[model samples]
Target: MDEFEKSSIEGRVIELADSSRREVEQEANEAKAEQQRYIAELLKNSSKTPIVVSAVLTSDHQSIRPDVLQKYLDATILQASSFSQLCEQADLLNVKLIQHGMAENVSQSLDSRGILRLPVIKRHYPSLVYESQAISGELAVIDVISRLNILPIKRFTAKTGTNIGNGEGDGYLQFQLRNMFGGGEQLKLDITKGTKTHSSYLLDYGQPVTPWWMLNSMLFKNSRQFGNNNSIDMLIRGFRTSLRSGFQEAGAINHELFYEAEWRTSKLLSLHASDTLLFQAGDDIKSSLGHTLAVDRRNNPIAPTSGSFLKITNELALGKYWKSQVEFSQNNSWLKDDFIGSCCTFRSGYIANLNSSKKTVNTYDKFHNGGANDIRSFQIMGLGPKDLYDSIGGDAFISYGVSLFSRLPIKKWSHSNFRLHWFFNGGKLINHNNAPLKSVVTQLANQHSTSVGFGILLRHQVARFELNFTLPLTVHSGDAMRKGFQYGIGVSFL
Candidate 1:
């Protein structure tokens, strides 16, 4: 406790205190190092590259094999840029598979007491515009799984707005099963049920004339090609329609069955064949309406409604220069009805690609109903005389025509096309007695006319929709046959 003793004690105490502080600092440093190591390990594990997997489950939900999942992961890696990308892509593929009816989860049984879960991962990238604007660089990654509940099967019936006054309704029921097969072509089936009614009245004197009930069946399949260019297609259809009139002795029924098959080769040549059979049964109009009404003179009285048709078309590409198509169609309706009608058409066209312009020329030869149904060029009017020639006993004859078209691009999304067409179309109508050539010529002079004209087309196809305007340069009699200028809307698939 003396002065010397007090200094010695203070020195000893200071040394002790410094030594304790050093020890504590060393321990703190060691602890900090250990904490850093732990954090480094955690980061390493998180960055160890995620193991991705994908599976296409069967209808009877079963877990996919590990090897199958690995294969899918490998395939995905080949297309992905990073681990995060791979996870996101897997989720997207799974969603797509489910949407396409390719997979299902069966964690929940049909008892409706359990929940089924599916995993989904989402990633965000810097938006292009935002990045260019130097905005916040923050990005996000979200991972979650959704649970879907299973419910019992139930049936329901409902009436649609399209249902006429008939109180008819539609019913539907669906159920799911597991253990279905995978890894095959996608299948799609469509079933439609509906009814159509057609009624017509005379324009001159409005009156309820005929009410028809039609039962139509239409089936379509997704277009599939075997090779890069070859394709095979098939279709089957049927229709039954009935015409009823209270004043008539009895109603009439018409039935139609059609089948079509097409085979296209790799060389871009397509061959199509179709067969159609029609059957009709009804009261003879001649005895019912023709004798009673003077306005029914142009109507078919006691006409045969049953008929058949066979059509074949061969489309061939003429090298890089042109394309040629030929079609032959025969109708047995006239034969069954004691009249004869048939048609043969030959179409040839050439496409010219110039430095600043393109050109096309098409020619056709048609027999039957003049060039009405066979012509590919624009038609000035839908109205045509019933007869123009006496060569054939019925209203049928042969005609040929040609059309030339050229296009030039005036600006982006805008183009101008010009078409020049000439047609020689004429046909004949049959009467009770054979008509002489002179008389037929006189009738044709009064009822028929022919001409050639040119048309200009303007079109643009830049936006989601396409617009076009067609104007005739030389307005011939047939071109102006209708009263108003022709203006149309909507895009053309052609």
Candidate 2:
């Protein structure tokens, strides 16, 4: 062989070996990087995958006892697919949690084994410092919440707002305090004071709707002015105070049940005349234990365009008199073209006095129908019964109100909150005492009051105002009928 050929072959063989070695080293490095990524992802959901390790909950300065949390969580935490799944389990398991107690996903921290440390998961809970208070059972966590500094025991707040209406304009001041402690248990106190210019029994019409002739005439004081028409105005002032406490009964996805104790007292500070006209009134002190169930799936509470709302409250007053009241209301709506929202509200209530107390249920509380907040066809409390010039109210009452809303005809105001609604109302109030059974059932139903009306529903962010004109189709003899136009302005609708 020639010397030049032999030298060239050896150099080519060396170059080939170097090239192969470089390729092998690069492949090994890439494989290692890929394996680390796989290991990291596997750690993220190790509890859900083939790995089945019991969740070890840990905390910082917060003293969280795993033994207590696991008692309520049972074995669900072991099977949770991810941190989010674990949180879902915690929410449903009747455990106490701080305001922003769960936010661990953002911190991609790791332990010695490159696995997510349970302590880092718990660090997401920033506000709470947990302590064990109960001596026995899983419910001991509730005791921990009582001593939690994250939630305060009491807070006082006051609000002053303009209370405007079709016939009355007034300002109100209300003070409230709500205390939250110990596993959703709560205590609330409320005080309200307001003044209004009102008509007979706080139902009928008042100025400035009252014509000038009726106000200036000498007969204004003596004529049936207050009765025939609610033109004679009277200044009224009242103060009310209420206290409520509730124990956590149960909580589900969108519903909650509260077992509550309620005490309420109201005093009429001043009134115009207490003679034969404003006859039936006295002090009332009512104490009640009740269960209130609220299920809210509404898309919007301000102006619900869709979804549903249900509230059922049943109370029993236990004392010298055993009086019970049950109230149920359902609100539902549908939006057409995502803008035209139509809604219907159905509410029915019943009250009965079981004992023979001089201060019967009728003496203090009655079903007052027909108002912007209720039927909207007549004046407040003007639909059912009348005791001479006053609406004395009734024991058992049922009302059905259905309303339909659509865009205004004007193009410029088509999407504005100032819109139009048509409604139909039908209901009856029954006083079972001194009344025929047939009348309470079917006979009065023949005279069941019904009215159809149209109104302007002016909606704002905080309130709703309405102007209505109603025509009664079926009016009973005693019903304070509104023959022509009726005006109502309030925050809610029938």
By lDDT, the best candidate is 2
Name the top TM-score candidate: 2
TM-scores across all candidates?
0.22, 0.53
Report the alpha-carbon TM-score of model 2 versus the true structure. 0.53
lDDT of 1 by residue, 111-227 (tens): 122332222223223222443665543332222222222121111222323322112222222222221233211222233332211111111101111111112222232222211
Structure candidate 1, residue pairs in collision:
59-178, 59-179, 59-180, 60-178, 60-179, 334-339, 388-427, 389-427
lDDT of each: 0.28, 0.48
The residue pairs that clash in candidate 2, if any, are none
Candidate 2 local lDDT, 1-494, one digit each (tens): 68889999999999999999999999999999999989767657542321112434343312323343344335333444344444444343322222112111111121222233244233222223347653322111100100111223233456767655644555544443322222222222323333333321111111111100010000011111232234233333232222322222232223222222222222333354333234433333444555456555555556767666666666666653333333333444445544566676666666655564454553335567776677656666777666555565776677777778777878788878887878888888766653454555563355578899887877777777777788787877777666556666544566
Instruction: Output the TM-score of candidate 1.
Output: 0.22
What are the per-model C-alpha RMSD values against the true structure? Answer: 29.1, 18.5
